[model samples]
Target: MTDLCVEVERAPRAALVRLEGDLDKVSAPAFRKCLAGLAEEGCVEVVVDTAGLAFCDSSGLWVLVEHQRTLSGMGGTLQLTGVHGVLRRVLEVTGLRPLFASQL
Candidate 1:
C-alpha cells in the first residue's frame, strides 16, 4: 500500500496541490481533507500536480470529480497537471480527460 502525500502552496485565491504515491481507498480521506481545507480557505483556483502520483483508483477519481464540480459551482476552477501513464489512460477511457483543465 503506497501512502499518499499531499503538499499545498497557497497564494491569494489560488492553490497548488502536489500529490504523490497512491490515491486509493485508504489514502483518499487524507486527500479529501486537504482539498476541503483549501476550499475552506477560499481557494477559488486549484491546480493539482499529479507528476509524482504513482497510482489512482475509482475512489480517487471520484474525489477529484467531486471537488471539480464543487469548485466550478462556486465559480472556481480545478485543473490537473503532469498527467501521464495509467492515470492518463484512465481519464481518457472514462471520457473524463476533457472534464479537467490540463496545464501540461
Candidate 2:
C-alpha cells in the first residue's frame, strides 16, 4: 500500500484534484475525502489529475466510478487527466474511458 496524497485547488467553476501516490484499497478513503470537498463546493466540473498516480486497485476504480455517477446526478461532470500505463489500461478495460472527458 503506497501512500496517497491529494491536493485540491479550486477555479471559478471547477476544482482540480491532484492525485499523488498509489490508489488502492488503502488509499480509497483519502480519495473519497477529496471527492467530498468537490461535492461540498458544488463544483460544476472536477479535473482529476492522475499524473502522479503510482498504482491502483479495484477499490480505487470503484471510487472513481462512484464520483462520476454522483457528479452526473448533480448535473456536474468529472474529467480525467494525465492517465497512463496500467491505470489507463484498467479504465479502458472497464469501458469507463468514454463516460468522462479524458486527457491522456
Name the top lDDT candidate. 1
- Cα lDDT of candidate 1 equals 0.91
Give one digit per residue, the lDDT tens place, for model 1 in 1-104.
78998999999999999999999999998898889889999997999999999999999999999999989998999999999777898999999988898864
Residues 63-104 of candidate 2: C-alpha lDDT, one tens digit per residue: 988898889888889999999877899988888898877776
In model 1, which range of ten residues has the least summed lDDT?
95-104
Candidate 2 lDDT at 31 equals 88
The lowest-lDDT stretch of 10 consecutive residues in candidate 2 is 36-45
Per-candidate local distance difference test: 0.91, 0.87
Runs of candidate 1 with Cα error greater than 4 angstroms are none
Error of 2 at 21 (Å): 0.6
